[model samples]
Target: MDWRLKRNCSMAPRQLLAFYLSLCILSLGIATMFWFQGARMIMTFAWIELFAVGLALWVVARHATDSESIVLRNDRLTVEVANGQQVERVEFQPAWVRVEPAHGDQSLIELSGQGRRIAVGRFVRPELRSQLAQELRHALRRWQQGAARPSPV
Candidate 1:
């Protein structure tokens, strides 16, 4: 079984880029009109505003794909978290993994075993984080039970 969770992005990176391009064109066109009218400061301020907004949008686009994936296959449980440009992947034996909230019921879910720990469920709502933890625990339990059953020769 596998569970994949991702940020709910209203605008994709391509759509965001297109929107920024249109905004730049409109702003620059207006600034050019002001420059022809002898309001040179408007053009300068327009450039500054565009630069600031572009930087902010870039940051948003960078994290648009942030997500967490948990996979249970064979005897291993793998968790992968992607945040901005960094990705952290951890694997554990299903029998030894622990799933719980990091701080409280509304806090992020923590998975720990073998002296390693990582938090997940950041994209999930705080009210539903405990449910996510419970689902993970159930999946791990099922995996462990399946692993323990005997197979025909």
Candidate 2:
């Protein structure tokens, strides 16, 4: 069976804040070094840091509010939106699996079928984890039973 879905990614407010703060600290650190070194070298470093931060910010903002959570297909289980990268080609083979919402304050969906465990949505909100887990469980069952729809991909 082959399935393809587009997943969206969103980060928690605290996480976003932390990331921004980290970036700011990094920028400041570079600026401080420039200050001690005088004008020329520091100015160049500042521009580079600004460019890096701009790219990072753009990527984060663009994918942060995507509505799709996870895309599960025949040969791929892509988790979209972590640093704008996709985790794909996850095996959907059913092998004694348990699907559950992870314990803790985070909104995370964890899949443990056999000895393997993977965290699907560490960045998603807690309220959405159940639905995602249900979808995964259904998909896995279909795949395990050899009932999945055939895919060209």
Candidate 3:
């Protein structure tokens, strides 16, 4: 068996920030041109341009949420989320950290080890992601506590 499971996800914050920064720089160029032309009509155009920029930011953030994937396998745990042209990957082993639910049965889960916690599945809805995190935690915790080694993945 291939033993690979893929979950579609989104990009990280740094990537989103970079994309937004670039967009703002481009929007500024357009705004500067309008100001230099002294076109009274540019005022109206500027507002529209601002709206367009806002829309672009929203698209990038929303797209970042959709164009992501979480891949789990035996040897390593990999999370792939994209923002703009950048792709981010986070990987670790079961023995390295602990996965615990952050909220109720319907909340996101917390992955922590050696004094750090990363809440995974931020893009997914609260309830379902919580359940998933719970299941994974329960399965992995047993192994960490010396119960039994889960078959890799």
Candidate 4:
């Protein structure tokens, strides 16, 4: 079983870059017209505004692909989280892992075992976080049960 959770982005980073470029063209074109009319401050302020918007967009683009992936296969359970340029990966045996919320019910779900812990479900809604936790617990339970059973020779 595998569960992938990611942000609901309205636009990809490439699309965002295209939109920013178009905005720059339009704003700069209008600013140039105002500059020709002797309002040179318009061009200066346009450049400043575009710079601010570009910086904000760059921050957004950096985290556009942030995600959490949980995979249960065989006797191992793996959790991988990617945020901006950082990635964290953890593995545990299905029988030893514990699934619970880190804080309150609405907080992120945490998986802990063997002196290691990781939180997940950031992209999930607060109201539905419990449901996500429940699902993870159910999957882990099934894996544990399967691991406990003997295989036929």
Rank ordering of all candidates by lDDT, starting from the highest: 4, 1, 3, 2
**In model 3, what is the error at residue 48, expressed in angstroms?**
4.1
Per-residue accuracy of model 2 over 22-89 as CA lDDT, tens digit each: 87778778787778877557756776777787677766665664333345456444433333344333
Poorest 10 consecutive residues of model 4 by lDDT?
143-152
> Which candidate comes out best when scored by lDDT?
4
lDDT by residue (tens digit), candidate 3, 34-139: 8788855765676677678777666656554444454445545555556556666666676776766777656656666655455566556666775666666665
Where in model 2 is the C-alpha error above 4 Å? 1-92, 104-106, 149-153
**Candidate 1 wrong stretches, greater than 4 Å:** 147-153
RMSD of 3: 8.3
TM-score of 3: 0.46
Worst 10 residues of 2 by lDDT: 1-10
Worst 10 residues of 1 by lDDT: 143-152
User: Global lDDT of each model?
Assistant: 0.92, 0.59, 0.60, 0.93
Rank candidates by TM-score, best first.
1, 4, 3, 2
Provide the TM-score for each candidate, comma-separated. 0.94, 0.43, 0.46, 0.93
Residue-level lDDT of model 1, residues 1-153, one tens digit each, is: 888999999999999999999999999999999999999999999999999999999999999999999988777789999999999999998889999899999999999999999999999999999998998888777777685334767
> Which scores better on lDDT, 1 or 3?
1
If candidate 4 were superposed on the true structure by all CA atoms, what would the RMSD be? 2.2
Return the top candidate by TM-score.
Answer: 1
